[model samples]
Target: MVLQVSDSDPAKWNLALNNARNIQQDLGKGNVAVEIVAYGPGLGMLKRDSKVADRLAQALDNNVDAGVVHIMKRQREAWAYVRP
Candidate 1:
């Protein structure tokens, strides 16, 4: 199973991480995959220059891959977005 977590709220990001932890605990005996895609304002949560970078870095250390996708981009501007 692939557990895809995506949200824009900082609090919700915490919830998603907690959910992944819980799933890991419950399914440790089985095979499960988790992927967290952070975009939009949520991208702020995983910004290379963000305060939460430490936490997100830890998550990445724990096998949680944080990714960013620019859903819209123009010569003058860009829009990062994600959905699950």
Candidate 2:
């Protein structure tokens, strides 16, 4: 499953992490893959200084794939053209 987070809000980061955890628990270890794609301001959630960085680290330890998309400008808007 893919969780797309476009905002830097801590709430969104927490929600995505929780969802990933839920899926992992439901699937019973290595049964499924979870990918978190963060762009725009959301990229901050993955930064070392961010409040949720620990949670992000935990998610990675749990086998969740986290990624950031770097764009020149209007990153959120760029999502509209990203295909699957």
Candidate 3:
């Protein structure tokens, strides 16, 4: 699944990250395909002083430590963010 985070808000960052974590927890980890792709302001969560840095670290750890989820990516190369 593709989960996109486009805002700089830490709350939105958490919502997106939590959705990934919660999904991994609810449905067995590594069982399903998941991807968190960030773009524009959403990339702030990767900065040194981002408010969601801790949670971001945990998410990274979740992948590095256990290899539960798939790799997290920064959107680029003409990514499609659909608008309805």
Candidate 4:
């Protein structure tokens, strides 16, 4: 099962990512498929500029399907209120 968490808070985003990694780790000890997508403000967690990118990189390196979609300039302008 894939849990889709959509939130802007970095703390919550980090927690969710870690939780996903832990679950994937345990499940992979046996057999399971898992992935995580961080979009919107949550994308900040995986931002190319964020310090946490290394940790995110590590998770993705471990097979977590971590993905980030570039918010286009138009989308950024339209969603400026929600993005940091």
Candidate 5:
């Protein structure tokens, strides 16, 4: 499934994250691949003080070595500013 997030609203970020989580849960872990590519203003939502940090942190903690991957490498410069 392809999901796109384009705003910096915390609510929108949570929805996108929840949707992705739901899909991953529904399909069963490791049975499906889910990736999030944050770009434009949406990338700011992944910044140091965004509201989504805790959820993102939990996800990173759980999946770091699980072979599940995400984040956009399209614009390397912009990507350089975001940390898991």
Candidate 6:
């Protein structure tokens, strides 16, 4: 599953990571793949000094794919358009 984060808030990052963990628990590890794409101000969540850096590291350790889009404006608009 693909999880998109557009905010840099720690709470949002925590919630998204928690949800990913819950899904892994429900479906069994290695059975599912989670891709966390962070753009705009949300890219801060992946930084080393981010408040949720540990959580992001944990997710990475669990084989979750995390990435950041360099073009913020375009990525944000694309995400907005894709969301229901």
- Which lDDT values do the candidates have, in the order given? 0.53, 0.67, 0.61, 0.53, 0.60, 0.67
Candidate 6 weakest ten by summed lDDT = 62-71
On TM-score, the stronger of 1 and 3 is: 3
The TM-score between candidate 4 and the true structure equals: 0.55
Could you tell me the lDDT of residue 53 within candidate 5? 88
User: Once superposed on the true structure, which residue ranges of model 3 sit more than 4 Å away at CA?
Assistant: 61-84
Model 6 agreement with the true structure over 4-54: per-residue lDDT tens digits: 678988888887888778878999878876556676788767889999988
Candidate 5, residues 21-58: lDDT per residue as tens digits?
Answer: 99789988688655555556876776778889888777
Residue 64 displacement in candidate 3 (angstroms):
15
TM-score of each: 0.55, 0.69, 0.67, 0.55, 0.65, 0.69
Candidate 2 per-residue lDDT, tens place, 1-67, comes to 6667788889878888888788789986578766667766787677899989888887774322334
Q: Model 4, range 1-84, lDDT digits (tens) per residue?
A: 343445657566567667667766887735744445555566666666675677677766432333333234324445321221
Clashing pairs in 5: none
Cα shift from native, residue 78, model 2 (Å): 21
- Candidate 1 vs candidate 6: the lDDT winner is 6
Residue-level lDDT for 58 in candidate 4: 70
- What are the C-alpha RMSDs, in order, of all predicted structures? 8.8, 7.3, 7.4, 9.6, 8.3, 6.1
Candidate 6 positional error at 66, Å? 11
- Global fold similarity of model 6 (TM-score): 0.69
- Estimate the overall C-alpha local distance difference test score of candidate 4: 0.53
